[model samples]
Target: MSLSSSVEFPARFSYACFRLTPHSVYAINATILPQKCRLSTILTAPSFDELFPDALVNPSRPSDLHSDPFWAPTLSVDLSDASGIWIHLGKAPAAQCDKLLINVYKEYSNDSSRVSFLETLEVKCPETAVKWENQRAGKYLLTAYVPIRGCKFLCDSADKHCRQCLRTHLSLEIRENRASFIWLALHTMKDHSYEIFIISAVLVGLIMLVMCMGMVYALWKQRRDAKRVQEIQLTMYVKAMLIYADDCVEHRNCMRMLVECLRHCATCEPVFDMEKLLQPDSVIPSRWLIDQIATLPKFIIVISECGSRILDTTESRTHHLVQARPFADLFGPAMEMIIRDATHNLIASKRKYCIVRLPYSPEVPANLAVLNFPVFNLPDQFGQLTAFLHDFENIDQLNISQPLSQSRMTSFREAVRLQMTFFEQNPDWLDTRWRPIDEPAIPQIREQRLPVEISTDEDRIAAAKLYGIDPPRADSEDEETGVGPSNERQFMLHPPANEPDSDTDDDDLSTSEDEIDDEDEEGGEMHTVVFRPDNLF
Candidate 1:
């Protein structure tokens, strides 16, 4: 009885039986291989001269199996020492095939060159699988059968027969069934080392592909996060404050132009929004300026004639804008406190402020004399401003370029009083004259009740009455509606000619009709003016 066993293996691992065991064989074959399979055999062990003497009966080893005429006429099967028969099949045949057979014989005796078979099992090609007991460590004779036309061709199973098994040529033809037969007797085993090497190469390739893909994704994510962080940094805004005078038309126009120019500075616009302060209808407060100065990076002040006058002037001050020289001096001690309170830290000049002065008026002082403060003029290339803005970080406590001059300083309350007086007299000038109607209204200057000892002119005195100040009633100035100081002689105060008598009433009529007539001839009105010695003295 003959047994035949044909098992499918991976094409890449063709003769690599040990490297790719039965477990890995199915996984690679089912997923990667095609329907067609290519097969090559390897033989090893005892030499064929001692095993099959029929093929070389004339004492000559045949190099080619097809050298025989009977092996021709059909497929030419090469029986080599290193490589045996090669087969290509489109699809596997059924498990049971009468034409293909395999015979397995277990060797029982330990012999030097000859042995006898004990147990035998006949396997029908691939259909009926033969299970041999003690297959772990044993010697066996296994022969494979293939169909050749209507005949059977026999070949030894590689690596199955060992030293204990007898090397013998067995040709079996049952019931004279042979039409034509080609038999490879006692085929030796062959170890195809190159096939095992090919399987290892494929596994390494798959691992490298997965690692490359992971590296690519990681690099892409790193770049994406870096780009997002850069964008956030570019668009962030830096705190800033703007200072300017709006006392005259040219000053206002220059400041408006500057504010618009700053708005057009695209890079700096993200860092500062000075445009809001210059908005026509914006009513910015005096404290708002201080607040911003206490908390922002850049402070821009337009140096002009109006600014110079206020800084120089000590006696009279504007209604809304306090003299900076005096205000700074008045709050010199509180400056550090105010700055510390606003920022919650000690003052850091570089981080807290970067002052820029624009000379709107050519008459600006040769030196603003502010220490550590730099003035930037309007450059021919406006783009430089945007570049300059990047130097300063956001902070509180910004000082304008112009420093407080050494002069007679007033208290904050006194400065406020002076501002109130000017605004009271010229309220419209503060609110309506400079800016457009649609713009934000200017902050109303808060009115302060000043001591009457500081007497204003008669016009201011009359304006004061509207603000609840009680003034002495006029006597002769009434009844005549349009009577005012004539162009002939200016109104003058004259001292009394004679001291009043102690017996006379204080309200007695002192002026005679003859003196009034003489004064009428002289083209001067006779007037009795009572002066307050408390104010004049």
Candidate 2:
């Protein structure tokens, strides 16, 4: 008998990416524990080439049946995840021809693998299978199987890029019969290497992507936390602030409201003289204020049309406004302290002082405005002010009422209405008046001489001014138009009780008047001019 032996070998529990075996090895689940199977380490006797020789000699015919033999034509078949491949032996002859042969073998798709089929098995191909197995064959064993150690498998599939089993070829022959048949045959199961490579690349890319994202987030978080810690480390004390404002009714109200808000916020201590700001005629408590100015962290000057007016150095300290400003006394001391501390103190001058402009207020001091202090126009820059006052990283202590209560909101609305009304009334309330100035008095006196051509009093006075001589004192008894010194009566000097009252002013002149009657009438004219009681110079 021509030698033929059955051989069996064990398979690995599961295949990984290790692509191929001698026969079709398809696994549904690689991790599942395999059933107990008897194993053999022994390989096939000799090898595949020696057993299935190219030459066959027929004993009955006495002819050499060798060289290339005709193989039956086969239909295309694929065996992946093997349900087992069908070999359709189409239209067999009506008479029994000879012994039929079924064969299976495998080799690597690429030429790189010189190692042959590495394992084997002896189990015969099942003739029929359950419905799910989908076996399709009529009579002859329609499927071929082999122990992996033996050889042969095909290279062609529709997908050309896939690994092909080295153009595996199949052959069949019949003895003492005329053989005419068609059949189906399969090469090998697909190893899925190309698809697996792509999937693994995508999976690796996804894992790397996740790792990169996580690293980026970690770096960002670390930076943010470090910055916050540094800020906290450098934080200064919240400190204190002093408010300087005008005597305006609305301004005072707003200042008081701000004071209240600052009180609510634990951020900074507000140092303000409520008494001086509130009272109708309060003066500065200079003695007490000395103690207050000892520490100065922040100083807020509330600016408004009214505040600007009050803060004016020369204008606000005028006669009327000086009394009008309730904080007049306080302003002087406060300003003196600020200027003293601020002089050459850059922090005190620039940083410590802040100017805030409320709505509907425009007046600003020329000197103060020139200082270029940080100006916050509110309620817009209110948040900026809070940030400015805060020193701690997480401590947001300067919380002005954001969502105010209804009552407080109503009050704020009312204040807004008042401010709008004030806006409507322009600069009419500003006092533009200044103090009056005066110089010493001096009278313009005429010349002490007159012209002789003068007849009337006007002419005589004119002539007196021109000639630089005395004019007649005898003109009007009621008015003194004369230029000469006349003997007018002295209230201290009185005529003797015995003597008659006379027009002469001098007691000695009365005696001279009697002597004048004895002189010429021309002398009488000079005499008359000198003795008139109405004459005054």
Listed in order, each prediction's TM-score against the native is 0.24, 0.32
Tens digit of lDDT per residue, candidate 1, span 416-477?
34444555666575334333324544455655565444444464345334432223333433
TM-score of 1: 0.24
Give the poorly placed runs of model 2, Cα more than 4 Å off.
1-242, 275-284, 310-320, 324-329, 363-366, 392-410, 423-427, 432-537
Sum up the clashes in candidate 2.
Answer: 16
Candidate 1 ranges with C-alpha deviation above 4 Å: 1-234, 269-284, 313-347, 350-367, 379-381, 392-537
Candidate 2 C-alpha lDDT tens digits along 1-537? 101233254356443444333233222223333764322111112122322223322335434533233222121122222344323221112111122223333333354233243232122323211111232221111222222212234435675654321122222111112212221222111345677779899999999999999999998987766555322221344555555545455555777666655555334567767743466664446655776667666777776554455466665554323333323435545766676676668554776777777676575567777676667765555545655565212323233333234465466556756766754684554443222113222233556652244335666445444433233334233235543444342212223432323333444444544455566455543323323323322
Candidate lDDT scores, in order, read 0.37, 0.44
How good is model 2 by TM-score?
Answer: 0.32
How high is the lDDT of residue 523 in model 2? 59
Give the Å shift of residue 412 in candidate 2.
3.6
